[model samples]
Target: MRRVVQYSTGNVGQHSLRAIIGRPDLELVGVHAADPAKVGRDAAELCGLTEPTGIVATDDVDALIALAPDCVVYTALGETRPMEALSEMSALLAAGINVVGTSMVWLVTPRQADDWLRVPLEQACAAGNSSLYVNGIDPGFSGDTAVHAALSLVTRAASITVQEIFDYGNYDDYEYTGTAMGFGNTADAERPLTFRPGVIATIFGGLVRNLAAHLDVELDDIRERYEPWYSDQHIECRMTTIEPGQLAAVKFSVEGVRGGDTVITVEHVNRLTSKAAPDWEFPPDGQSGVHKVVVEGEPRIEMSTSLSHPALDVTEAGCLSTAARAVNAIDWVCRSPAGLVALEDIPPTELIRGVMW
Candidate 1:
């Protein structure tokens, strides 16, 4: 069995945790958490997973590496200290362990920054005879792969837009609503761009950039805008009423240039009322939306994704769908030309569905 180590303590980590469960081909090896209190606790329990299963969370990353797992799945929040976290991931890959992660604004490979984060890691992985891939539920599935799939048939494509609206009205889970998107008072507002410096090249930014690169068009320009949700009157949500305050409804957008020099656009938004912005043209998932992707072309392609989970921003179905693509593509990256790669680098037919049902 292939041993996989995971290093995330929240929703992203949850994706990895659920991915490894009950899989005979892969073994759940070790888990790493930042909280000292969580250290030494069984990972399954930390995740509210019943049955001690013998896998424990450890604070000692070095020790975890010493265990020499074949691969590490990193899902830690990459915003606070992305470079540092990436450095740690690089070390593990250098130590000869294949690495997979989703700690970015978008995809992490095919970077353009002068330092270009993934290069050194790829070089290290190659040196150590390992491989690395950065995967995210949205950026990987709904945005990039989905867009790539759509663009495939366009002989004279004009533009593409993607949306993933989530209805969180029924979301009874606090962690799912609050922290999945950092929804405190100033969370949705204009705050200092502290982490994820390459916000454009991160998340959908990189995918947008990659698309432009694939089209062989010079990047026209990139811009980011935000919308704050404010309720004039107290709005009732389940048991609680939300007062007037600005939490973000939209985070960022990238406007690209096509070969015709026409502008192509890709955007990411957090939450918004479907009724609030009828003028925006962007589709709203429903009440308390979680994930939404809208793609527009010469004609148009609109896909609305909704998942049902009692207590998470992304449903189990969403995570499973995304992870299955990443997990099954492991062999593709292993065999492909070594370097930073985007979804466009691989064939869409390679998508690994958990089952044919």
Candidate 2:
């Protein structure tokens, strides 16, 4: 069994802990937690497991690294702290610890990342002779491999569009709901991160660029579109409520265009409730959350994914999928060459489903 350490206890990180423990080939060595309440707690309890594991959570980064575990599942948040994540990953790599995590989703297609950040990470990998792989639901299975499989049946390629449509009301994170996404704010307020100029390019544009590269197409320009929908009436959720005329829904799209035609695109239609945006695109079953990919080509293929766990709700299950994506890739990353590993670099068979069935 490969010795492993989990780097955080967030929603995804906790799920990753459970995954690592259940894996037949992995041994849980230690866990890291930044929250004062979580530190010193048993890893199993922190992850909501019924029993305790000997492993306890700690805030000491150096001490955890000193354990010399085979890999670190660094599922800590990175969207708001890209440089900090890069620095941490670089140091871990330089220490010869292989890393596979969901923090930097764009690293699934590393070529699309900024050169400045990429250079130091590459150098660190070389120095320590350790590898790093990053992935999540959107930039991982739901976007890249799914789209790649759908496009294989087509003889002619026209366009590709990948979308994530979900309700964000149950997501109780104050920073993400109020500040980053403007979920409970008024319609006139400044748009959220998805709508902000260049933000999409910085975060998810990697999907578009990577798809274009896979298709061997040169994009003329990468364009973005944002539309925020307001609720006419009050909407209630488990955590917070959306008052009348508040920002209830948002639609964001990034397209890879070539000579006026869209070849690759990534889109999201997110709302606080299903009632908030009745007319927005949804799965045939009208599910509130789904990741969809459409190939507007010869076969005109379309595929959608909806994830659920027995103990978790739809949104929480989505978080688990993100964690599973990273956890499942841990062994492969640890065995790979020391450098940035892209989605294409790994064999598709390596991503087989686990005990989740």
Per-residue alpha-carbon lDDT of candidate 1 for residues 223-286, written as tens digits (9 for 90 to 100): 5444445444444443133556634233556566544453556655544334322334443433
Question: Candidate 2 on 29-118: residue-level lDDT in tens?
Answer: 999998999999999998888788899999988998899999999999887888888888998899999999988766878888888778
Most accurate candidate by lDDT: 2
lDDT of 1 at 300: 61
Candidate closest to the true structure, highest TM-score? 2
Q: Residue 263, candidate 2: how far off, in angstroms? A: 1.9
- 201 Cα displacement, candidate 2 (Å): 2.0
TM-score of each: 0.79, 0.96
The local lDDT score (0 to 100) that residue 159 gets in candidate 2 is 80
- Candidate 1 at residue 44, lDDT? 77
What are the candidates' C-alpha RMSDs? 4.3, 1.7
Model 2 residue 177 CA deviation (Å) reads: 5.0
